[model samples]
Target: MKVLQNYIKATNTHNFEEVRKSLHPNAVYFFSDQTCTTHEEIQAYFENGWSIVQEESYQAKNVNWLYSGSDSATCTYTYFYEGYIDGKTISGRGRATNIFVKESDEWLLIHEHLSPLPK
Candidate 1:
């Protein structure tokens, strides 16, 4: 629960630095429209928002969770994301499954896969 909370905070604030803390150095991120294989790439993707966009809301759902050990877990959830670009609201809501691994006593995201919800 606490790890998820920190992840949300890092996302909402667009705090890449904080986000990095929760990400494995070689995390794999498969988004609705793109895939990133490294923390730096993900950071760059979010960094773009600071210059041309703003997040309006981000909501998570499903929340099916499991723990494999003190250092490993898998979380399945849906995310509803809304953002503004050039004053226009763009929304993308989808289901996501993420695998998290604790490294050095810190939970770090190791992999994520996101898919669009059926209309």
Candidate 2:
């Protein structure tokens, strides 16, 4: 869905309102070092740590919509990403699974789990 692309771009660019547009009110986001399950928690995560990321890109590989119902969809994909952190360029790839729920006919991310592939 286009929303997915918007979500990625918004997060990479640290566009607060744009990113929030794609997330559910109670969406849950999982990070390598922490988890966010509430609006406040997620917002804080983005405002604090996520905002520090200056350049980031997330590309989906072998993406599959495992289940697509009238109101929900489950997607599994490999996310290849690279970015700069504190002036040092770093890169990593990971697997991403997410649940998108339709609200008023628009899909919003309800749950997301992302983990890096082993070295």
Candidate 3:
């Protein structure tokens, strides 16, 4: 969906405000190490990640929409990320699930869960 694409673009910008524009007010995020249920927590988590991973670029691959309705949609994808961490180049792939809902005639990301891919 366009919203999902926009969200990914926003993330690449590494600007929290731009990213926040794509999220629902009450959005929740599940990361490999922690869960964020509040906007403040989510913002902190994203900022911290960006700080650690300089010039990080993230992408979603093989996205499959598990469910799509008039008001809501859910999708799963392989997420790839690469960047420099502590002056060393690092890259990884993970599994991601995102849930979005239509609100005020626009789609907003409500929930996202990301986990490390299995060996």
Candidate 4:
């Protein structure tokens, strides 16, 4: 949860480095329109958001969670987000599941699946 909390803070502020630190070196990400595996692709996923939005907000709510051993954890939550993009306000009420693994002393994200609610 610490890693995820930092990730949300980093993402809302567009701090890519902190966002990167939250993920494992080989993390996988899935979006409605895309999936990312390599470092370049994952970095691009975060970088690209800067081009489309000058400001954004993200909050996780209504969480259902579980801890599996000392090395693994999983959680599902309502993801609330809004962005200022191209002179318009865009937002989504979504759901996401994030998986994490303990590496040494830090929890790093191993996988994530995010999708928006239907229009």
What are the clash counts of all predictions, listed in order?
Answer: 0, 0, 0, 0
**How many steric overlaps does candidate 4 have?**
0
TM per candidate: 0.84, 0.84, 0.97, 0.89
lDDT values of the candidates?
A: 0.79, 0.81, 0.95, 0.83
Between candidates 3 and 4, which one is better according to TM-score? 3
Query: Which portions of model 2 show Cα errors greater than 4 Å?
Result: none
lDDT tens per residue, model 2, 68-95: 8889988888887777788987777798
Worst 10 residues of 2 by lDDT: 49-58
Residues 1-119, model 3: lDDT tens digits: 77789999999999999998989998999999999998899999999999999999999999999999999999999999999988999999999999999998989999999999888
User: What's the CA error at residue 18 for candidate 1, in Å?
Assistant: 1.5
Q: lDDT per residue, candidate 4, 1-119, as tens digits?
A: 56678778877778778788788998999987899997679889878876676677888888778665688989988898788887799877888999999989788889989998656
Judged by TM-score, which candidate is best? 3
Clashing pairs in 2: none
Cα lDDT of model 2 overall? 0.81
RMSD of 2: 1.9
Predicted structure 4, TM vs. truth: 0.89
